[model samples]
Target: KWTWSAVFTLQWLGLSIAWLDGAEVLYTYYYPTHIVLVGVTVSLIWRYYGR
Candidate 1:
């Protein structure tokens, strides 16, 4: 739920950016960066929110 909303927002943002810019940015930066960010965010959520 928590990460869902954040990730969802990022999904749209990334989509918009990719649509506005081009495939270069989407593949070069957005893919790697978004993957790392999602990993980190999920890790943090697990570390702090887990029982």
Candidate 2:
């Protein structure tokens, strides 16, 4: 439920940005900054929960 709420919040933020600027939805690089953020989040979860 919490992850669903987080996804909803991210969607709302993305939509707000896209509404303000059509270019906000565009991904300009093969290696985007958000990918790094995702990697860090995954690594943290793995560090805490991995066997």
Best candidate (score: TM-score):
1
Error of 1 at 7 (Å): 4.1
Model 2 ranges off by over 4 Å: 1-15, 29-31
Give the alpha carbon lDDT tens digit for every residue of 1-51 in model 1.
Answer: 766897889878997898789988889878897888888888988988896
> What TM-score does candidate 1 reach?
0.68
Against the true structure, candidate 1 has what lDDT?
0.85
Give candidate 1 regions above 4 Å deviation.
1-4
User: Best by lDDT, which number?
Assistant: 1
* Model 1 lDDT-worst window of ten: 1-10
Model 2 lDDT, residue 15, Cα: 54
Q: All candidates' lDDT scores?
A: 0.85, 0.58
Every model's Cα RMSD, please?
2.1, 4.2
**Candidate 2 lDDT over residue span 15-43, tens digit each:** 56655666545354222544664577678
